[model samples]
Target: MSFTIGTREILAEPRPLPSKTVRYLVPVLSLIVGLMIGAVILLASGHDPIAAYKEVANRGFLGELPMIGTLVIATPLILTGLAAVVAFRMKIWNIGAEGQLIIGAVAASGVGLALGEHLPGWIVIVLSLLAGVAGGAFWAALAALPRAYLNTDEVISTLMLNFVALSIMNYLIFSSVSFWRDAERLTFPSGRFIADTAFLPRFWGRLHIGIFIAIGAAVLLWWILRSTKWGFEIEVTGDSGRAAAYAGIGVNRKIVSVLVVSGGLAGLAGGLEIGGVMHNLDPRALSLGVGFTGIVVAAVARLSPIGVILVAILVAGLNNSGVGLQTMGIPDDIVLLLEGIFFLCVVGGEWFLRNTIRIGVAGQPVGERSVP
Candidate 1:
């Protein structure tokens, strides 16, 4: 469509499918632009942008320990990103992944404590992970049922559930004398640590097998969505619910199933954190905003399951640099600001990629066209 204001004419035309190169180029360009904008902000605030960036690179990727730390941070992000991806693909806004993760951790921790001392290490780990998954799935089902049958908005339901989940977790350890609480410590409330037998096996320095598990999940999800009938139905429903119903796809069932699966993935992330890293349901340590970061990761990856892994790693690197940035006198908020800016730029890039823009004098023909 074309419009005119004052002496200027503007045109916005729908763009065709972008070539592979263009598809890749847009995100890179957006990221570069985001960084440039951040540099400008840094300079205006009396900081050396170059040094800040260098520090970020050194702490996030250059050193072996830092690189491993980045990977460790990215472990849960991959799962949560996948969780967002699955629901977003079907146009279902499951924003409750945060709550789901908390619930998952709670259930996993419960299982670990119950089985840790009695069972073998591998069995305890397996049962704990399964409990986490089930917990997450069940939590999501609360929102999904209303969304599927009563036409409730999943976004609000899911988002609100996050607080409820957090409250429940806090109540268990902080406010009440629950089983999850460590009774030995009377001065301060603390979560009881699971037995050593429940801990996940580590491969490298502070790195566990969860990374591989996350990657495997991405691969499996990719395959399921690409090669299976269920995946086909999901894509169709996402594209158009009415059309999907016309095609005999059970839209309600798909909605519940997809969201449940998404929640399960997020739950698995919590379970892994407990088994591989925390070994306890410590609310202070668990609430790292990783679930919300997964949403950003999924968006940056354009909802591609495999793409989520790579984007999660990139985002995790930024997070890993937060502590180092502090030593350089940069506030941690700046890192979050940069992430917000980057997400905005990527979203803008998506819009530009889907439309062509042209400008000219009001009475003149659309002279030149620009494609993002």
Candidate 2:
């Protein structure tokens, strides 16, 4: 029997137009658009957008002590952004960064209290930070173990763990006679003061050595992701789990290890907050949406560590406008609303950057493309 053969052709796929400039331009434009829309809304609501914006700029970036407060706010964001960047780069949704941070703060507070002037200042600081790192890793293990062994949804596990961490911290401060509680102040849920030796030395202003720590972390992480073998494995795993597995890159090991490191980074942020800023571990102080905001930071920065630092500073400045908004007869939550809008626009802009919407003919695809 003979078989008839027909000509076969591989169709051409419409490639995403590569514009090195648009990679930066689109995000900047998206931000401007978001701001314009927010301003319009503010005007419609009978508020002066210009005045409000001016006050915010005056209080934040353009004010006296120019970058100090902004840097202070950006510190935790930098580390948390790194945390999200690592997990996201590996396609691991380690959403429990907040919980890990909380636990880390708790652990650091414990170490400070235990050491309490009994040890050398240097030793206390080092041990407290290490305690925070260990605490975050330990907390992350709760989710990582389940994910690695049982193939559980890390999103749910990590998110659920956040509430657990918050509840546990709250209980220790308000409902129990835990070390975190301040016996001297019976009127509130504030935590006891950590030893002064545990404090990170301040710079000229309220800024502390934590800023340097965060900058160093960004530099170190940038190097690791760009030049290391493990980083390549993570990128591969994120791109294709099956391919990574075939290449002998143990998916489970990568998942667990990366998440642990991610959590540790966030925990370091928490430790810095307690040691450098708050001077004590309070659930309220730590739950300022820093972790969630870091997600936005990671996204806005395109997952680059150095970019994360810059974006984080800008975001921190924006958030610091809460008081200024309130002064301008706008609710403090206006910043949050504007943030939500900006995040949506940037995310949508990112999608548009990577994909094109074509108005094809009736028979052709409108949004579908096939690879050659």
Candidate 3:
């Protein structure tokens, strides 16, 4: 009795890559759709859509001071956006940027206090920035470790860490005798003011130096991701761990590196918030929710470094107008609702781009064939 053997090979159908034009146009279209939806909601609720939108536009972008304020608020968002873009592009989830930012600000403040009046302005500024970067990196490394070694879900770890960071910041301001505590003022919670030497120099009277730093970071990230070997490895690792491993890329090391860099950028944003703008580490002041807002900015920008800048500005403008909407007889909560809509549209766009939807003919498993 002889048996005949047969061999066959199966190949996966290649997916067509979306064109660059579509890649850019989808986000723009999504934004338009989100705005239209928001307008419809506003009109249905008995609000004048045109007037409300006009007010939002005027307050958010038409005035000089308001525009400057928007940019000021956008600085941190831009940094956090970059942070999200960096980690997300490499398939690393770093939801703890808020905590990392707080820790960085605290650490930077400590460095500023330690230097006191004697330290040169240049040295203090440099040291404070470094301290911020180091602090954020340390905080993020904690999550990175479990993720790299044990395959823990970074989303859960990062989110939980945010609460821990907030607690630490709160402790420093209220309960702890840490360097950030304000001794002279006991009524209100406030951290010690960073010395002028450590403070970031203001530009154009309205804009802080942090804006420049954010722009520089955006450019650097763009260059690194496009021109560096490390960036290539990150992209490959993100696409497929098995493929990256086969290509000689150390997956764990890449994960650690990406998270650390991402956290560092986020920390820098916090440091700038204290040193450049706020000049003090107040817990309330730090809780602008910019870190979380950044997630939206990153998603809307499709995780592109350059796109982060524009998206951050758009979000910042919306946030600025949110305050003005209340004055115009519109509920401030509506602004938050608009933001939620924008986030949904952006995420939905990404999902649509990556998937195809099909309707079932008769409600049975759409793709399944019945055995006769």
> For every model in order, what is the number of clashing pairs?
0, 0, 0
RMSD of 1: 2.2
lDDT of 3 at 120: 95
Q: Residue 39 error for model 1, in Å?
A: 0.6
Error of model 1, residue 212, in angstroms: 0.8
- Output the better candidate (2/3) by lDDT: 2
Candidate 2: which stretches are off by over 4 Å? 1-17, 63-66, 357-372
The candidate, 1 or 3, that scores higher on lDDT is: 1
Q: What is the C-alpha RMSD of each candidate to the true structure, in Å?
A: 2.2, 6.6, 7.9
lDDT of 2 by residue, 1-372 (tens): 112224322233344674988788888899888889889989999999888878678767986475788889999999999999999998898888889899999998889888968998778988898888888888888999899889999999988998899999899998888878888888776899988877888987798999999999999999998899998898999999999999999999999999999999988988888889998878777788888888888988989999999989888888887887787679988888888888888877786576544444444334555452
Worst 10 residues of 3 by lDDT: 1-10
Model 2, TM vs. native: 0.91
**Candidate 2 least-lDDT 10 residues:** 1-10
Model 3 Cα lDDT, one tens digit per residue, 234-291: 8998899999999999999899999999999999998888888888889888987888
- Candidate-wise lDDT, in order: 0.92, 0.85, 0.84
Query: Candidate 1 has which clashing residue pairs, if any?
Result: none
Which tens-of-lDDT digit does each residue in 1-372 have in candidate 1? 889989988878877787888888888899899999999999999899999999889998887898899999999999999999999999999988999999999999999999899989999999999999999999999999999999999999999999999999989989999999999886888999999978989887899989999999999999999999999888999999999999999899999999999999999999999999999999999987888889989989999999998989888888899999999899977889998998899878887678767777888767544453
